[model samples]
Target chain A: MCEANVYLIDKEGNEKLLLESVDKLVPSDESIMLENIFSQRKTVKARIKEMALVEHRIVLEEKD
Target chain B: MCEANVYLIDKEGNEKLLLESVDKLVPSDESIMLENIFSQRKTVKARIKEMALVEHRIVLEEKD
Candidate 1:
């Protein structure tokens, strides 16, 4: 499965796991839409920070 | 090979492919670090917009 675990990065460079087994990412206005294999969804005002695909990791930093 | 193809989302909601076969994403102070399987790297001043792991896709929106 190519699904990745999503993380949120803070200003202090700290990371927090936000979602797991995410299957879709859609961009809307100033936020991102996240959907998982189970069809769970979340919309957050953030940007793409990093993606560690091989490691099944993705990161996001809060927008100002 | 969990790497994903990265895309940039514009204000108009258009998607542009930015990188392919990306394996790593690191967040610096204000930019995202991208690395592919070939070890090529790019730093983009953006935030994490989305991650569609099932489709091997990731998206980013520019930060203002």
Candidate 2:
């Protein structure tokens, strides 16, 4: 089984977006991606600062 | 780490609903529950026929 999650970050150094495990991650643009799952999907666009893993959730923090 | 997912079923023996993993499950009535998480939450009401685990996602099927 593959555990999945989504996160978003800004140009700073803070975590701005968090998402649960999703079925697919599609990049729509240079700074954005479409997250889709069984329930719903959302669009996230931001400068990626950093990426990390929190337990099972994927943590994405913005760059400053 | 808790890998979670939500499922919904109708009165018959068929799977009609599926949701991503949520932070909590709140039962609002005898046949419904409110799922809450960081992104969003939705209400699901149906007769649960069976429950099982597929990989990490929790599968809930309706009763017939």
Per-model RMSD to reference = 4.1, 15.1
lDDT of each: 0.80, 0.43
Deviation (Å) of A55 in candidate 2: 11
Fnat values, one per model, are 0.83, 0.03
Q: Weakest 10 consecutive residues, lDDT, candidate 1 chain B?
A: B46-55
Best by TM-score: 1
Q: Model 2 chain A: which ten-residue window has the lowest total lDDT? A: A46-55
Error of 1 at A57 (Å): 1.1
TM-score (2 decimals) of chain A in model 2? 0.50
Q: lDDT of model 2 at residue B16?
A: 45
lDDT digits (tens) for residues B1-64 of candidate 2: 3435666645564554466655443332244343434556665554223222224343444433
Interface RMSD of each: 2.8, 15.2
lDDT tens digits, residue span A1-64, model 2: 2445656655564554466655443322243343435556565553223222224444433323
lDDT of 1 by residue, A1-64 (tens): 8988888886777889888998887766587788889899887887777567888876778676
lDDT by residue (tens digit), candidate 1, B1-55: 8888889887777889889999998766588888899998888887667666778
| Residue pairs in candidate 1 whose N, alpha carbon or C atoms collide under 3 angstroms | A47-B47, A47-B48, A47-B49, A48-B47, A48-B48, A48-B49, A49-B48
What TM-score does candidate 2 reach? 0.35
